[model samples]
Target chain A: MRAGKGLKWVTLLRRVADTQDTDAFAALFEHFAPRVKAFLIKSGADHAMAEECAQDVMVTVWRKAGQFDASRASVATWIFTIARNRRIDMLRRDRRPEPEDLNWGPEEEPDQLDILSLQQESDQLVAAIAELPEKQRVMIERAYFGELSHSEIADETGLPLGTIKSRIRLALERLRHSLS
Target chain B: MITHHLSDKLLMAYSTGTLPEAFNLAVATHIAMCDECRARLASFDAVGGAVLEEVSEPSVTMRADALSATLARVKAQPPVQRKVAVPPKDDVIPAPLRDYLGADGEIRWRSLGGGAKQMVLETSEHATARLLFIPAGTAVPDHTHGGLELTLVLQGAFADEHDRFGRGDVEIADEETHHQPVAEMGEDCICLAVTDAPLKFRGLIPRLAQPFLGI
Candidate 1:
């Protein structure tokens, strides 16, 4: 069923890429737009800004659909990256002096062994996150979802800056170990 | 090969898109040269995907016309023409830096004496980025940071109290770090440095020149 669902998304993306099909886009919008909005809100964007950013992210996904490589990243991962970048762009709108450069360029093709290992690691990510201790999980959530800097997290949590950095570092070490 | 690398926390912040633009530039430039860091970043991106999957759906719903409106906009707009980045023939500068350098493709360096020169890159108000060129075996004045400083070696290597930094390596220094960085003998060291505030130079000459340098 998981494999089937992944294939479905791949097909939908292909349809949008090949034909610029609105129907395919609509399906994607229905599934991802609300999630993107929620993700933005979790990152401290107000509701209005989150809604607008979500709309922009979907538009970008539509325009850049042709550039998506299913072999390199899953559809969900790709869409999540778009949403994250769009939120950052929104925050940087007035402050940034230069145009947003979103091009990551072509990633080097992975060897078969690398691809297999990465796939296995990707599959374990969710479980690894679940296994994190409560304090570590909270730190990760604040850093990733809340979009708080170390200092900001320190301020909010009333923890020393050094403590925040050390805890987050430990959590990342565990995640890296499990993923590797 | 890079002996030093960006900390995992920095890479995680970068992958999650939480870094300010200056830090983002440093990370992107370093990732351009280091394949290992790029692959590690991909894993962090996968973690972001997992975290997104677990975020419970919000109670707020989109406007009823959101999807239709998006489709209409998509139909109205022409397909975007993406400019494929040409890899630089000169290995000295990578593609990410090239995007910022623009047409002239040359840096106008301001000499800082002692065979060191710098060219500042315009960025956001929160941080400053500059390209520093230090001749081989020369030492930068001993100083500590007022805020965070992230430096990526683009050409030769440098050594400080912490460790040796080679091509594609990133050195993150904070207010607590105070050391003089010396370029390794071989080639002039070229680095992309981003800092939130000016350095606190210990020497009278460097301290006097700091204001004029705009670092």
Candidate 2:
């Protein structure tokens, strides 16, 4: 069940990639489409547009499943990139440039150990962010959600992230003590 | 080896899909040549992934037919996107940069005087993307940025008040930076320079329309 619980989305992607298995694709959609739609909505798309784009993103997910490499990214991270790119295309008139493919041939098979560590790291990263003080967490979320202007992002981040993280912690602790 | 790299803020912006198209192109080209930035970018991407994973289930659900509809579309579309035709690879220019230059990576450069030349790549209105060629020992004009500047060295190298930027290196300058960059001795320098605002030329009359680097 540990294996089953740890984003078996990775394994499911393999099935979808190898056999065009609709079952695996359905499972992925069931888990991610709503989140993708919400992400779009939060990023300022109207409901109708977000709904339509979510489907489009999921379809692209299935289409590009063959290119997914588990060693480098968790399934959620991979899907997030697809959703983000689709959002960019929806919002921007200009073409977005993407980094070149790592190589021309087939995506090399990810090592089993590498895949496990990546998934673990992804899980831990999510938990760590979840634990951030509201002020700190909101800033990050705002940055990712496009709530902050480019200048605001640039100016606010003048301090190193580690410095800001500690500042937020100290400020939050002081507030907590005052309340207590 | 790449000595300079993109800022964390810029990388996060790239991961978040908030950067202007020109900046995106510059960052993409840099990541193609630099693995350290590539790894940093992947970790930043993981944050987005985590956001998607732990996000509260939305109040709204996927339309009932969303899956079925997607499957039907899948039947119509091939499992893989048709490969974009691969142009012959340039030994120096990276793939994403090549994609924008289009067809053999040929560039037509306009003189910027002082043996420095530039070709502005067409990008969205939010920013300007240009390629600069400086003969060895040539000096680009002194300028300060109105907003932000990101320059990635593609061939040879250049040095300014800050440091030497070599192939795969990126130099990020903002409003406060004021300096002149001279192509290093030996090979000539070729770089992709992007700016979010007009470059304020120091002590030069502004050209009619070329607001960047007093072209």
Candidate 3:
């Protein structure tokens, strides 16, 4: 699965959110900061700017720690959102309107079983992406990482969807021509 | 309860942070109302998380002191969220749209004739977004779309030749579609409408007024 860290990142995030623990924060930063930097750079940030933005994102992770809900989102998913918003802000792109919140802040803890299942779903998703053909995998990376502009993104409603794809099915069909 | 959810294309674009601001507003506003779409959005977001978590070797690295700097930054800033389940407000405008409308959240309506009015929200150059008001028993002038148009009903209901859209329903129209939407009889209807291109009107009066109406 992941590296030598036996503890879940959610556990680490809980420590950060509840007690402001440095060791936990360091563990998270060590794991996530590099990836955030790499993601920003792929999204068209310069080396220096990506570094600064990654730092800012980590700080936000610290600040918004209490908002993380394992029942709903994995730590990587949450951090990806934070990094995406930071990219938009730093690039001075158009304001990204967030969907209305169904609920605000963290509430009661989700069932541990629910948390485990969601993380498993996320991990399965990662494996699924890894198993995709190289061309398909790159297409996904390009779309999420800012290589495709909004207009350049495909919207062909007529293309067929295979049963194997998930919610991203149509988006994949739309991204088909971009690679060519 | 949202029957007409956003297309997977729109939701995935939103999840990837690639949609125009206007479209983003439409999607977010719809999601605020539809938990199904929100759950769908979360799945799309997992794809992003998957991409981020994919173990590609980094060509770039964060400076060694990155964690220290982040910790320092957090010292001055308290954890900024207190998500205490703020009950959805009674106002017609949802939270994301409220920010763009009047600071008091009052919609300043401009007349579009036939008991329909509109308030265009300021978005980027990529697209146009507006709130549309149609009194009960009124019909918008017949029209077709040049590009994509997304309409999400917020209050009351409306029916066109295609289908009936109620609160939290999103009806998407593209170039080939043509319909005249009439508000359902029981209540005045309010909707959030976003378009990538201007609408084409068929009626002589509306055609003449199109230059001034900005529809």
Scored by lDDT, the top model is 3
Q: What pairs collide in candidate 1? A: none
Deviation from native of the Cα of residue B168 in model 3, angstroms: 0.7
Model 2, range A1-180, lDDT digits (tens) per residue?
A: 145334588889888988899999999999999999998888888989999999999988988888776666778888889888888878863466877654222423445665665566666677778887787777877777767655666534422234222322333233224333
Q: lDDT by residue for model 1 over B1-215, one digit each (tens)?
A: 78778777777767666666677788888876765566566656666766665666669668888888888788877456444533334367777676667478888788988789998887777778889999999998889899989989989999987799988888988998999999999999999999888888999888888886786
- TM-score for each of the candidates: 0.79, 0.87, 0.89
Task: Return the lDDT, model 3, position B90.
Answer: 45
Best by DockQ: 3
CAPRI category for model 2: acceptable
Model 2 per-residue lDDT tens digits across residues B1-215: 77898888888888888888899899999887766677777777877887787767548688888889989999898688324324334467787877667476788788776677888888888898999999998887778889889989999999998699898889999888999998999999999999888777766453433454442
Q: What are the per-model C-alpha RMSD values against the true structure?
A: 6.9, 8.9, 6.8
- Candidate 3, superposed: residue stretches over 4 Å from native: A1-7, A102-107, A150-180, B81-83
- The TM-score ranking, best first, is 3, 2, 1
Name the runs in model 1 displaced over 4 angstroms: A1-7, A21-23, A93-123, A150-180, B78-90
Interface RMSD of each: 7.5, 10.1, 7.3
Indicate whether candidate 1 or candidate 2 has the larger DockQ: 2
What tens digits encode model 3's per-residue C-alpha lDDT throughout A82-179? Answer: 99999999888878888554433343444555566566666677777888878777877898997776555566422122221332333322222222
Candidate 3 docking: what grade?
acceptable
Give DockQ for candidates 1 onward, in order. 0.24, 0.30, 0.36
Q: How many residue pairs clash in each candidate?
A: 0, 0, 2
In candidate 2, which residue pairs clash?
A: none
